[model samples]
Target: MPRMLLVTVLALLCSACSSGGDRYDPPGLREVTAANQCMEQCQRHFDSCMTSSSSVDSSDRCGAGVATQRDTRCDTIDNPDLRKRCQASADYCRNRLPALTCGENRSRCVSRCGG
Candidate 1:
């Protein structure tokens, strides 16, 4: 009976340990969905800025502002996967930003956030 009890306890202890796939996300690590949502909000802000009647900000200015906003929100993500994806998108969009309109820039900027 003591041998059986020890075996049962050992089995329970082993089961309690986490395996490779069961690992939890690190603290402050944002999920990919969160990244996507953040980018969506950034796009909305850019759209609003572009349509606003304020003459102080040009379309190019709006594009720049949204790019800043995107980086501020998405670039700071703690998750490595999300950060890598966001940076790649930002790089791709920024390179073409000078040639594209604000709306076009926004689309490219948020493209990679989606899983």
Candidate 2:
């Protein structure tokens, strides 16, 4: 009887341990993710544009021009609210890109995007 009771208790404990909670994402997460992706694309485009527009010595001027173009393009997003959020995220990325390493930049942008 003691052995049977022990087995039952163990089974109960195992079942309890295996109970997986709901796996739902928080609200606005999808939107934020989309905006982050868009911002990354914009940044890549800006980098490419800068590379083609000027030599290494003129990088500062090129970067400024590219940033302005990126902001203009990002700001025209169809959804006003999303455009604002995306532009904010893009601005964050632009401001921090020169100061942070690649991994840190990604982490900071993700956090800034509300992820």
Candidate 3:
């Protein structure tokens, strides 16, 4: 009931973002391509964390999974700076996941790319 409504609402919000441009492509970025790339990475990490949890777990439980994934996943990036950026993005995304749509999340992640 409530879960289905939430899913439908999310779908509508996501569709709105896609209507303008690629969902990950934040506008007016000096490096659109770079921002897009960074956003994609952040989105993947966020989505994976979200899907890993059950409805019973909801956002807080999923947030813990994001933290766990951040440690393991961000450590894999060879570049120390990029690794730090990834972890930071994960932290920001996890903190706000319950309140933001995926497009909003991706937009916020532009900072990780220095955009």
RMSD of each: 16.2, 14.2, 22.9
Clashes in each model (backbone N, CA, C under 3 Å)? 0, 0, 0
Could you say which candidate leads in lDDT? 3
Candidate 3 similarity to native, TM-score:
0.30
How far off is model 2, as Cα RMSD?
14.2
What would the per-residue lDDT of candidate 2 be over residues 1-115, giving only the tens digit for each residue? 9999999999999998888967787669788678878678656755664554344333243365565666788767899888788777666655554323344544665566556
lDDT of each: 0.64, 0.63, 0.68
TM-score of each: 0.29, 0.30, 0.30
List, residue by residue over 1-115, the lDDT tens digit for candidate 3.
9999999999999998778664564456557777778877987866764565324344354454666777689999999999999988776755554435545665677667766
The C-alpha stretches of model 2 lying farther than 4 A from their native spots are: 14-20, 24-33, 45-111
Q: What is the lDDT of residue 32 in candidate 3?
A: 75
Off by over 4 Å in 3: 1-64, 100-115
The TM-score between candidate 1 and the true structure equals 0.29
- Root mean square deviation (Cα) for candidate 1: 16.2
What value of lDDT does candidate 3 attain over all alpha carbons? 0.68
